[model samples]
Target: MRESEYAESRADFVHQLRIAIKEANETQYWLELLHQADYINKKVLNQLIKTVLKS
Candidate 1:
């Protein structure tokens, strides 16, 4: 293969890799946010239970 063709192919590969990495990072962020929200909800529920028991 020609040098220019090889370089273009390599550039395309790099671009695709960058896009994949970005998508993976975004997915991880969403998962972490979901986990944090779940934890907060549990804490709120516990607080509500404690308040009710004290009443």
Candidate 2:
């Protein structure tokens, strides 16, 4: 691929990565809120936490 093509690909990757990170952060925030409000059981919350940490 040409140098410009490679640069464009890298930029797209970085943009996608930033979006994923933002969404993950938002998910964690919601999970925490749900747990605090007793909307989620301890076991389920623990499982979710483990899954999120692993990712």
Against the hidden reference, what TM-scores do the models get? 0.55, 0.69
The 0-to-1 C-alpha lDDT of every candidate, in the order given, reads: 0.55, 0.72
Model 2 TM-score relative to the real fold: 0.69
Write candidate 2's Cα lDDT for 1-55 as tens digits: 1223344577876776676667667777888889999999878888887777565
Q: Report the C-alpha lDDT of model 1 over 1-55, residue by residue, as the tens digit.
A: 1223344577876776666566656655555565577854655655654553343
Q: Looking at candidate 1, what is the lDDT of residue 8?
A: 58
lDDT value, residue 46 of candidate 2: 80
Q: What is the lDDT of residue 26 in candidate 1?
A: 64
